[model samples]
Target: MATTAEYNLGDFTYPRGWFMIGLSSDATQTPLAVRFFGEDLVLYRGASGKPHLVGAYCPHMGTHLAKNTTSYVVKDGEHVQGDSIRCPYHGWRFGPDGQCDDIPYSPKAPPKRACISTKKLVERAGCLWFWYDEEGGEPDYDLPEFEGYDEPAWVNWNVRCLGELDSHPQEVIDNICDKGHLEPVHGSLNMELFENEFEGHVARQILSAGHKTLAADGGEPMTNDTWYTGPGILQSKMIGEFPSLMLIAHTPIEDGKVKVWYGLSVKVQNTEPTEEDRALAAGYEEAGVDAFAQDFEIWANKRPCLNPMMVEGDGPFDKVRIWYRQFFNPRARAGEFQKRVNGRYVVRGTNTHPWDNAA
Candidate 1:
């Protein structure tokens, strides 16, 4: 088990996953640039109706890809078609792969080396994900198994919200394990705290809660499991190992302000949603929004260090916090910590927890 005191805030990285950029309906024919993973990336549908992500800034002179204003010359100038984004300042065109394709003023094509990097992109479950590291490392870990995602038994309702917080990623993450705050902040009961584990680049915390509200009555006390992978991915599942419901949240924008995006999937039975079913689904979505808002209020007011010093008895779920630290801290990655597993002390990187395999 890891503790809050052991977490190294500096080494935390965002996990890779499809993060919703507002909503799918908002995107039209025009290209839009969104801040993600500390950089601006452009998102637009290719001719094939699939979405694509490219560097937002032109490699030449740093002009923004979205700021250029040139009208299309064909079919009454209604559509814009080109192999790459054209820079308004110098008319330099960059291809989909972020490579410079042409310079209008130059006599010949631009050098092959003149190109901005293009990130590998995918749209899944109504969200966009950019691979910050290597391509095809493994199709992202399987999305949490939820009943509503593909089954007709349950109706799935999804909601998207954005919050700007003055806290680090870790601060927001710690909220999932802070069992003490649920009663007061969320008006929920604290059932019990389970163990947390850190394995490879993934950190997980399992929490049980019951009787949070009347609507949640008669329902099983949900076991919320949060998983953190290297870099920028965060996922939360509402069921136990058999995750019947799942939510994926990501911080696409960095700097002093963090932009958080959430997508959820619910399991529904075989039937159209009735009024009661709709109300229940809506209540769940509202609960999630309110819960995150509560966390945002606290994190926004915290100091930049994000991970405040833990005092005695401050975190009853300190084990989860510590496990996250051991799993993610660069020191642990470098083999600096000895983790005990199955009554044996093993190097941090070599030992794998059951959750890691399950995830």
Candidate 2:
């Protein structure tokens, strides 16, 4: 796999953005080990019912905080106390803010530097949203509200974790502008319209087409409006027999590897969904996952495309790559990258083209 530097993305190895680390159920009172942005991290829910993310190693003796199961601290159920986590080896307790709050054996107060680094975590929509920034800055933008979880008319998404892949996320991100793949990979038919709009940290794709995987049983064509809130957190609205708010999230596990997940929150006729309605929604979600797997399979096997061999009919791949570069560089220079590629691009060959519509 190619590295981020090989693609010439920017100075940072990983982009600064809100990434989905795991499903909400994965975080509980018991500490769980997780890796993201090329760092070992631990995730645990507090007794107060709030989830937290911190560096995996204890600051004192470099013990794997969540990796120990045989320690007395873990067996006695003292590994997690209230909202703080205790290191298994030395019993050093770190609060949610990542400061060393207590040291049981220490006669003196905790040292000034006795702390493990913490991460900013936001739990929403049954997923743990992690804000990752190399510069250690606050989130520049907010995560798009996955409101289906709260809405009465929509069935909440199951949010399946589709395991990790040994490919750079740049390959998956390129799908935003992969108009050529629709026909062959997904059996996209009669592409009436296809366009992409890039502005600020958002990259939008508008497509009107018929898909074998997504719109198989339906006679009506599907209209897909998809956008990435940042480098990760892709949300798409599918307009068809049943409208769905689809989610595709991928977080970097290492420089050239990533983990991905897919969910489809479906709208039903019921104001308050019945069991049957939920079952129907689950079926839709399965179909959506199947559609996404088409792309996932290709990304898993293909070599990295550092530079695409662009052609006349291809969508604006260069523009999409430039728009993505903003998240990798320093936030102050983000506008510089945005200004160069912020505009709507409509490619040729679709029925929406002037020549195609003519007699």
Candidate 3:
């Protein structure tokens, strides 16, 4: 309910990216509703064996599509098969595209305009994504490429966890840039700080954690690049900034509720994933989870939301936080920020209000 004006102390754009709404575990035989981009959407597989995203609310009388309570029918391209979804209130039939195909009470057939809003849905890498913004303005940026994701070299495994926090999305992103907290929060991995750079809405931190070895020397800086891509996507990379080393974090907030999906990728060799590798990955992930819990505990106890009003030195990583705000601030005056040749936002200086120059 907080309008952009009310929350706008400075300009910032909403981060944008594909967010994982539900796990394969949550959506087995029934249609599941997940919230993203400030709206609830029902995700279900169509009869054609493809996934679909439909508005959660029924257009006829605003009943939730989930209220139908019927299993989805797995149909071919031609007709409805078994376990189809039907509204209990009126037996109206909706397809995976959220179309109102059958109106049992109408003798003249359902109106053509009775369909629900269908989003651009993509299912990749064992997850589902829906485009929550307008299209045709620019091609959705490609997901950062990660090496050895499906190739040979290092072992790869992933774990998806559901996290609810009483903080804003920006707060979570700050954790990625907060280098000083690594020692105290995650038990001192002896992370050594390096260069920090901000471009556009993206921030990159080059540092080395003592635990991870590089090359034959056993200790080399592990370069991690953390990016905030407009509305909700926060992505990071390890070693190098290639697409193959990518870790995507999608956080969406609606009505004071925040949901986050942490997508991680690691290079794996040809052999099976070893238990030691799994344990190490799990340990890193758990550390991230614990750190987030600490932040949630603090944010929930705060009065107003944590952005726009942060004190001068409350956050030592305030530079990164301000960079993030400038990157995503929608009120940002258009044409003021430019991208460098390397494809990062070009910062003119330390000034946060880029629009101050706007006449």
Give me the displacement of residue 10 in model 2, in angstroms.
Answer: 0.7
Worst 10 residues of 3 by lDDT: 341-350
Candidate 1 C-alpha lDDT tens digits along 61-175: 7877665446442223222244455655666767677778778789977988778767666665555555542222443344333335545645564747565555555566665
CA lDDT, candidate 1, residue 135: 26
Q: What is the lDDT ranking, best to worst?
A: 2, 1, 3
Per-model TM-score versus the true fold: 0.72, 0.97, 0.69
Quote the positional error of residue 84 for candidate 2 in Å.
0.6
lDDT, candidates in the order shown: 0.54, 0.90, 0.51
Q: Which wins on TM-score, candidate 2 or candidate 3?
A: 2
Question: What is the C-alpha lDDT profile of model 2 across 1-359, one tens digit per residue?
Answer: 99999999999999999999999999998899999998999999999999999999987889989998999999999999999999999899999989999999889999879888999999999899999999999999998788577798899999998998999888989999988998998889888888899999999999998766556663247899999999999999988666789999999999999999999898888899889989999998888788889898999899999989999768889998999999889999999999999989888888767446521
| lDDT by residue (tens digit), candidate 3, 271-343 | 5657776565565556555645555566557554445444422233455555544334332332243232123
Off by over 4 Å in 1: 1-28, 69-83, 104-107, 133-147, 190-193, 215-222, 229-231, 239-248, 271-279, 304-359
Better of 1 and 3 by TM-score: 1
